[model samples]
Target: MFLLPVLLLLSSCQETIESKDWDTIEMPRVSVHDPSITSVTEDGEEVFYIFGSHLAQAKSKDLVNWEVPFQTEYEDLDNNIILGDIDKNLREAFEWAGKDDADSAGGYSIWAPDVIWNPNYKWKNGDKGAYMYYYSATSTWRRSNIGFAVSKTIEGPYTYQDTVVYSGFTQVDSTDGSDRNTHYKNTHLKKLISTGVIDEFSSNWVLNSGTEYNTDYAPNAIDPTLFYDENEKLWMVYGSWSGGMYILPIDEKTGIPMYPGVDSENQGLIVDRYFGTKLIGGYHQSGEGPYIVYDKETQSYYLFVTYGQLHSSGGYNMRLFKSDNPDGPYVDMKNQVPVFSSTDQNSQYGVKIMGNYQFSNMNKAYKSSGHNSAIITEDGQWMLVYHTRFTGGESHEVRVHPMMMNRNGWPTTLPFEYVNNEYFVSEVGDKDIIGSYEFINHGTTNDPKVLPLSTVELRADKTITGDVSGTWDKEAQSSFISFVIEDVHYEGIIVMQQDETKEQTKKIVFSAIGDNNQTIWGVKK
Candidate 1:
């Protein structure tokens, strides 16, 4: 009985990682947040550009070395990307959409810029092939707009196209109006009415009111991400906090939702709340920063999300979920589905892949390692581009690390950032598994301080003794190891990571999660 589930978990954890692909490259030290990376080949040399919050862009020939160049090939792109620059009629437009900024400033911040090559729409304007879509908003939780911009080149002076969709803009005319066209009276809204969510749509029904930004009919429109599905259909997954996440079909030609102006209550119904698939949310827990990457090789769409507070509080961490389809009911390692009302299960659903961590040769421990993006390089290197703040540091710095899938199709990140060191993947046996290790428990809490590494020991006699307490065992044919730590069963695989500070020394590492949804990471000491 236990063997079948163990086999399923172990098989999903294995991934084909080439040792040669682990190039010893060091990414530049820079402060940026919500990074999105794209690669382009110009004149036989491949280059990558990283875009982030506050309209920041950094260019790199190799993923490691970077330069913040404003002037590219075609244009000298402007630095300060203000909201007024993108759209002049900000107040009129947002009032028409029925959403207000978190602050009275009417939305000024640009965040999580996603740039991609739109082949279908490239020739229409006689320009280059890239389109950039970004979020502009105030500190307001639910008030935001996903705007469109186009550039002939990757490094762009991106021309603001138009506002795609406003999150809280359901009733078009909230003020005392004569006759106004609202999204509630639209066809999509009619469909949602048929689903029994909204019985009879009134202008008052569309109006949102709440202190927590949860009274809105739609999902919070921040953190926009764009990607094409297996059928070549362009789709977007967006939302943060309040109403959880949502998915909308994108019209390739217009660079917006297929049903653009329709404001049905069904707008936010696709993910984890009223009517949506509910990617990941908890009872008032922070569940934001949604990015989905479809790995063609695995035939699975991997959903990467950040949870907890995304501040220096050290609660922020990156987690993962995978599904066979793009619009999913995504499942995590334990096959637990994300629930909206329950704060317990969703907190433990996805594997906590990255968090406040410390390695051998670090000046300080890394905290709040979330809000990330992933890409497969032209040379087939899988990388996670993210921002992390060190202990006692005030600003967030960008970092890139290799992301490899396990035999069970789950992804795990390396302990250290990408540096000039080689990692090893050796066959594991009982001898390799028995050792003293430094372990840290990524507990599901909002604590600001990262847990200190605790020492644990694994005995060769199938008995376990550690900082906590447990019995250890391993499968005969695979590297799948499990142990009971304080009555909570934990399972994971043994892999090797190199310590560059010690003559590039290699150490066995284990990353596992308990049945209670807590994650345990260990490195051989």
Candidate 2:
């Protein structure tokens, strides 16, 4: 059991909501080793199940703190192979990996994973439509090939699929932006055998990059993130070394993009898929962390990219560009706005935001924290996902924090301490023709998944026992839920639509508050 200081019917603790129980979930181990987070899947209802390095991590309703082994493991003290026998099989696999050196070290060190849920997923049909795409690298980290995995659920004991496109672009520094000799020559010769002279390998270089693998190809390449446009055409943005950032169309049917795939002699790929001519005056370089976000509210396109080498001082950042088309030439609207800065600035919320602040002399608190992702809140606000520094010097350990967007449409992070101290009011009636809502007493997490919710885990069957006077409203015909609480004079508005699930149970995600007297948005869940 956990205990906490009771922050009574406080009206001012809105930004700081704390429940001690969340400490139950352990933090994922961080290291400079080959671990990474490629993708995460949430119910779109509440829980977020993240797929990464070795094991899958789960989180709570708020997507903050995280937990592992979301489901009861078969190898645990009290378990049995009673469910689907999957847990048991996974245990065997783990033991085999432990004992079998050859089995443990051979495959591509599982790099750049991505997961997608098929709308048509059906448990019985076996088309559980949850798919993942990741690349596997040889021990030398050269000749890496994209591979696929599939599972019935996002947090899976996934079954690995085969290679995607094997572009043998292994040699590094091959692009002089003018060299006709190296890989491109071999590439064109192969193209001659496939599509004839209709197309030749066409491409350029990004400042002659090199890799740790000594293969000369950009080791930074790979990690192909995908997104679909309103038109449903698939767009994939991925890059490594030798060549710079590249964007090409993916064969939607097969999920294969237009890369040479380490082998395709298709000269057209080299030509039609080259990124240099595609970029508007060559703006993107050493790009990583590509996420495509379409604002349904505004119908806009955003492509987020990470700049600089992860640990190198010359690079280390997050920059975004927008485009009218999913197949970019993306443009930086706010002067290539730096979304994740190492320096401190004015607080996002009125309260002071940072602790150790320094910019122009940017220090690497968490050397490479900018390969980030953002989520639009239910209320239309945006949440940024980036890791902060660990006390023990682990760099990539990530955390999700709420961000406040400026008028120019950029965001500043809400500090960890602020959320530790604020209180939000939930009432039943308000002047906006609603019910009175009071500052509902603090609560804790219930869902067991990655990115803990409520900042604390609570009794699973608990029914919000700490209610401090709150009211709710909804019209039978519409899709909105409103909470009017009394902690603050204004209504702490929350707008959520009940999800249509096979199970009739209801779940709530904090969306947006009718912040700014109903003009701007505020944090909810």
Candidate 3:
């Protein structure tokens, strides 16, 4: 029966070197939001281990099927849950940061976490191990703690280490170099907690410093990504919608800020002394989810971040900037402009890698595809792993996509979600490109679920047929596909990857986004 071969192919996709069909993929997950992956070997076999928000952790030998070993839910860390509503989380963090009354600022949730191997990290007993740097923040956007837990081995029940940074530092005004007490007296804030007096705190006051949430601190230490450069220098990039994104050098030995002392600017050890640079921000103040990957082949460091609200209906998406230097003056590929510029349209910069998109039929789609992590497999393949909320689905699920470089040296994602399939650089010429294909438009929608794929016919005469009428052509110089639908032009690169519906079938997939900010994904039928 047809079921036998289909089952065989699916098994091969997970267990062997055979090609995988995207349609047959059941993406692995634990509790998915902001999935970050790292590859390591266990017993001479490769494993793609995933970690995400809510302290969810999962691992897979083959990428398609996942098994969760542990998870830390919100209630697990809340002292109030056991004590009938007492704010113990912030108190412990503030105590570590040498402050009192941590109960003032009020948000409670764990966000994106970064797990990495610290080769030179030393424990008190002098044993080194892998570490997971994560955060806990109050919903009011006032208090946060970037803490870490370590494990003797890569796969582990990591023991809590310490709070690396307790947030709420007064912004560093380089102009004055003066200390501003951004942290409010805990006693005062607690008394005024019910009076809506916290509204006076500025969340995006970039120029001036204010108390608690209003501080102009550039490094909003929520989503932490620790990446080491080719030179083996460890760096930490963390931030979200408060001040902006920042990068800081890390002490290889202690796994803390390299220079853990206040600078001449009077900013504290966490804010000024260790703060590296403001990589990007200042748009709608929606910038969050900081992820950085250094591509040695291109001699560039790609800084990826989400630009909108991190919710299914909140227009969540991904954008990236590249820099030759690790701590950088990061710029976009186009015009060599700052990725986060006040003059330019901010969202217009950085390659829009993935967003709310659909492919095939109503069964296949993804939305709010941001808060990602990148990994280079042991076999030297590149992948962008993230979590997405599918159409008609309210839950977040992790998805992986192979990242490819276009003719311009910038990276673009293949149209399909990765399914442990073998993909190759597309070499089809103009003559071979004209054919019948399935086109999926990531139509703007608040409904979280998949939409049906439509049919499109690419004609040799540069005209389109079938479902929706459009003109298709390729750029003469770059050979990138450019097509017009509804008078909008989109440019894209093609790659040969597995078609979602057919097992062992390879097809040309085109992924592009229109000027109207709509993304289109097409798979050759």
Task: Go through the candidates in order and give each one's C-alpha lDDT.
Answer: 0.60, 0.35, 0.59
TM-scores for all predictions: 0.76, 0.50, 0.72
Give the range where candidate 3 is weakest over 10 consecutive residues by summed lDDT. Answer: 1-10
How would the candidate models be sorted by lDDT, starting from the highest?
A: 1, 3, 2
lDDT of 2: 0.35
Identify the runs in model 3 with alpha carbons over 4 angstroms from their true place: 1-30, 70-91, 94-108, 137-139, 169-219, 259-274, 336-346, 424-430, 438-457, 461-492, 502-505, 512-520
Instruction: Name the weakest run of 10 consecutive residues (lDDT summed) in model 1.
Output: 1-10
Candidate 1, superposed: residue stretches over 4 Å from native: 1-27, 42-46, 70-107, 126-128, 170-217, 260-278, 282-284, 342-348, 359-361, 421-423, 426-433, 471-493, 500-505, 513-516
Residue 357 lDDT in model 1? Answer: 66
Estimate, for each residue in 96-193, the C-alpha lDDT of model 2 and write its tens digit: 11111222232213334455544433434545345554433212112333445455545444554434433334124342212222242233325543
Best by lDDT: 1
lDDT of 3 by residue, 116-164 (tens): 8888888898776555545443222434567766665655445555566
Model 1 TM-score relative to the real fold: 0.76
- Model 3 residue 379 CA deviation (Å) reads 2.0
